[model samples]
Target: MASAFIGSSVKTTKGPSVAGTLAETVAAVSRWGNQPSSEDVEEMIRDSALARHAALVKYLENKLAQAKGKLKKVEKALAKVQENLEPTELPTDLETISDEERFLFRKIGLSMKPYLFLGRRGVFDGTIENMHLHWKYRELVKLIVKRKNIAQVKHIAISLEAESGGVLVSVDKTTQGYAIIVYRGKNYMCPQALRPGNLLTRRQALARSVELQRYEALKHHITDLQERIELVTSELEEMEAGKKFEVHKALYSKFDDGSIPNEDEEGEEEPFSEVEDPKSEEGKLEGQSMIPADCNLRYQAL
Candidate 1:
């Protein structure tokens, strides 16, 4: 807001002199047809005074206006300095560069922020929760959990430039129900799976390290798939229990009271109607049937 009283102050102060001169000229005006009188001479003096006063005022206004403009420029510069003196909060898209990180960036002659690599747009879309973590590392952790199908981070650690081409290392956290996944890159080696001790050559070590990392990374997924296979196998077993498993009836000590039913036994046998008589009383099932070839004959449920 520029001041409302800059050149106007000069105009106000010098305005009275101009008005006074004009008033004297008006008072000195002669009555009709009186040009040669003393009134005319007084009028001329008054007009000259008015012109000089007006010029003085014009000069003052120009000088004052120029001074006012300079003052405004000075005021703006001072305000910017004051603003710089006040502390500024960190921007949302940027993390505070630590002294060590600053040193590293200076060494490399590259200025990069950790948040620049975290691309978090549309991650939680259609999710029931509307919240997001505040920091980049936390967001990266969240991304890992979301992609790895896990709920919470079990543990997190960082090593500067831990990966082969990595510049820095970090982790993040997020919301959802997912399993945990750990990725250690090619630097991790397994003593039990691989040969004991380090590799024989640098090339062999690098290749073996990448291979081991791949296997280790896929190990959990393979286990999860195997679990799903077992689930499906159990379901199939349950569904086929009656049609295909009736052959185990003979191993069950079921006699149907030993009174043979009216079904013909001379023709093709009924697989579920002819079990051996029970030795133990309580393990008998309701009907008799042929024993399964794979049945364990020694164990009885009762």
Candidate 2:
């Protein structure tokens, strides 16, 4: 069966490009020293750039952690589902009821309200328990099965009788849906534990198997995205650090090489002040190119 939360699952496949955002912030600051600037202004620009980069990195780290948490949860659930799909020893002997007894029980069941409803997850352990509970008070247990054809309903009826130790009385059509009437035989004895080692039929297991495949794909995809994001974030940090070191080296080398006069020689040094920042026309284009077009919509959906 397909996942019920298809819309949400679709969004999870592709999330925000957080690494791209960090790269944009780094690129914006990389152009800082292209023009001559004072030390204080340079320091302020560096601080702003670093702060933004750190924030983006933190956000991506948190996102990665959340994806991992979800993957863990999915894996745990998948394990249980796989266990249910395994083959196990089931009761082979079944109690038989006469035609007269089946007709009488079917009449009784038709007039009574349904005790339980069965959907895609058919013939689980809980259904058997509930059937026993209803049988404790009455001879017949009525079940309504929906969204299934005649063959599937017949399969469910057979599985129910085998698992619950009840006699299959009749499978009838009613206004609500396909109705299954089960008669607890004259020699009925409730088991101490109704929970079976494995209760799902082949069809039910197939449905669950499909759902497991979807989650498996999703887990792997999230892991891939996390790796890519971390790689990009690391590269952005390295570029920022290297750019800052280069700027510092260039400024200090000018003083050491006697290019800028000292205070003793020039009588006084030029007062430190911010310079006129150049227009960064390429920054917008660079950021736009770094982020995927569909990432924003997917992130919002998430």
Candidate 3:
């Protein structure tokens, strides 16, 4: 009985080995002979897939590099805009310029009065309309100086209030020494303390104010737009880069799994075939026939 059991084991083992070897050989022939054209196409397909993956990698790298450059450029532009937006303090003392030095100021519809005062009274006062007109005069004077047509003025003074309570202006000439007290629409010659200087035009001052304000506003708007663009561009680049990385990973996995045909080798090892059970139905019948009568019939048949 022991010898019989050993023999049965040997048979089982030998049968599997012979069948496995036959199956391997048959599989090899079938793979080689039946689908040569399809195999070639599959190889080409795999090569194309690899090429596509490589191209994608290169594209993603280039995009990232470009995005970095663009981001840098945007940053520089934003910085420049911010710098330009900052308020520049005007000099308390006006710098002298050539007769041709000129600046333009747009009109802001405000009016002022020109006045001169001596002691507690006014010498001359007049209504001046439009602030931009004063700015234009100042610009013209600077331009004339820049062109060497006129000397630079050193001082400017203007009375902003009524002459009785305003500052004094004095004019001196070869034959006449005069003091002026000027308020809005009124002028008087009076003896009082005098303040001597050139005065800025109201038009010019208003124009400068408007220009400065507009410049600041435009700078802020540009800065905000640039920042938003930078954010969007960065996000887009990141998303595209992530997608590219995922595709590369999947392709690499495929290559590793041998799903892609081996380009260097003409052939590869065949996959093992699955074994099907022929006695499955018989086994089920025997399992169900557990009664004594069924067992006796099975013994008689054996």
Q: What TM-score would candidate 3 get against the native?
A: 0.20
Best by lDDT: 2
- As for candidate 2, its clashing pairs are none
**TM-score-best of 1 and 3:** 3
What are the RMSDs of all candidates, in order? 44.5, 32.0, 39.8
Q: Model 2, residue 138: displacement in angstroms?
A: 0.5
* Model 1 ranges off by over 4 Å: 1-108, 111-201, 217-221, 241-302
Query: lDDT of all the models against the reference?
Result: 0.29, 0.60, 0.30
lDDT of 2 by residue, 193-278 (tens): 86666666555555565556556665775676576567546645765776544445433322132432222542332343433332
Clashes of 3: 31
lDDT for each residue of candidate 1 in 1-302, tens digit (9 for 90 to 100):
24766655664454445556866666667434345667676555544543433443344344345435544654554344333122222222322345464343333221111211111111111110111121212222111222242111222111111111122222323222121111222233322322112112333333333433334433543454344445434533443353333223322213222322221431233232322322221121222211222212221110
lDDT score for candidate 1 against the true structure = 0.29
- Which tens-of-lDDT digit does each residue in 1-302 have in candidate 3? 99998887873443445546878889888888765587586556555545655554454445445445545655555454333222222223322222222111101100112211111111122212221233333321000001111111111112222212222121111111121111211222332333222222344333333344444444554454455445445544554464333434444533232432222431232343433322211111112111121111111100
TM-score of each: 0.18, 0.40, 0.20
State how far residue 65 of model 2 sits from its true place (Å). 32
lDDT of 3 at 244: 35
Task: Kindly report which residue stretches of model 3 are placed more than 4 angstroms away from their true locations once superposed.
Answer: 1-36, 87-302
